[model samples]
Target: MREVDLDVFASELAEGAFAIDVREPDEYRAGHVPGVRTAPLSELGAHLPALPADRPVYVICASGNRSAWAAERLEAVGVRAVSVAGGTSGWARTGRPIVDGTDARSA
Candidate 1:
């Protein structure tokens, strides 16, 4: 699976790339990159069909492990996906903006 650093991910995000947090709901509620939608790794299969095949999807998790797996799964199904190395923790550590809540958005 392809992997990208937080800087690259953030750049793409600014350009309107789609991103999904594969962490669980509670974990996501704790904090996440702003505007990223929730799609817990547990329910990823149900979300696969809706993902865009034409654009790269950025997948993130607490540290990167879950996002790696999620990225592979997405690619296996023909969706172009990239795992965000360092994940949300890295994004927060870099002083990037984060949104805390259920977000109420869908991808």
Candidate 2:
């Protein structure tokens, strides 16, 4: 699976790239990158049909591991996806804005 560092991910995010948080709901509720939708890795298959076919999906998790796996899954099914290296933890550590709660749209 393709991977991108936080800086590239952040730049693309600013351009409105699609992103999915692959961490579980509780973890996602605790904190996440602003505007990222929840699609926990466990239920990812169910979300496939709804994913955009024309754009690259940026996948993230608490750390980089799960997102990497999620990205591979997405790629196997013809979706272009990239895992965010260092994931949300790195994003938060770098002081990027984080949103708390289940509301993915609350930015």
Candidate 3:
């Protein structure tokens, strides 16, 4: 699976890149990157059809591990996916904005 730093992810996001939060629902509810869809790692398969395959998808989790796993799974299915290096934790540490609660879709 390909990987990208949070900054690159952020820039891509700004350009309308698709992103998925592979963390569990609860963890997602606590916080997540703005505009990211909540598709927990456990339910990735079910949501695959809903994800965009034409563009790069940023897969992220609490740390980088889960995102890496998710990215590999997505790539195996022909989706252009990339793991967010350092994941959400790194995003937060770098002072990136986060949204809480459900229904936090991109504006």
Candidate 4:
């Protein structure tokens, strides 16, 4: 599995990379990156098919732990996945704007 710093991931996201938040619904509803899809870690297997294989998928969580686990699982199945270092917290600390509940998905 690979890992990307929050700063680098931000640029990749801007360039159209796919990203999935693996946090639970409540956490995600509080705030998340705009346009990022949600696939809570608990249900990742079911969501796997929906993720694109042609491009890399970036996984993130409130911190990096859950995403790291998800990235490893994805890699085991041959998806080009990377875990976001520092995760969503790092994004907020960097002053990135997050989309709130209106854009959140049910997990």
- Local distance difference test scores for all models: 0.89, 0.90, 0.87, 0.90
- Candidate 3, residues 1-107, lDDT tens digits: the string is 89998889999999989899988888998999888988888888888888886788889999899999889988999999999999999999999888896665421
Candidate 2 residue lDDT tens string, 13-88? 9999999999988898899998899898888998888789998999999889999998998999999999999999
Off by more than 4 A, model 3: 105-107
lDDT per residue, candidate 1, 1-107, as tens digits?
A: 99999999999999999999999988888998997988889899888877888889999998999999999988888889999999999999999988887674555
Residue range 1-107, candidate 4, lDDT tens digits: 99999889999999998899999888888999887889999889999889998989999999899999999999999999999999888899999989886976532
Segments of candidate 2 deviating more than 4 angstroms: 105-107
CA lDDT, candidate 1, residue 100 = 87
RMSD of 1: 1.0
- lDDT of model 2 at position 62: 85
The C-alpha TM-scores of every prediction are 0.95, 0.95, 0.93, 0.95
Model 4, poorest ten-residue lDDT window? 98-107
lDDT winner, 1 or 3: 1
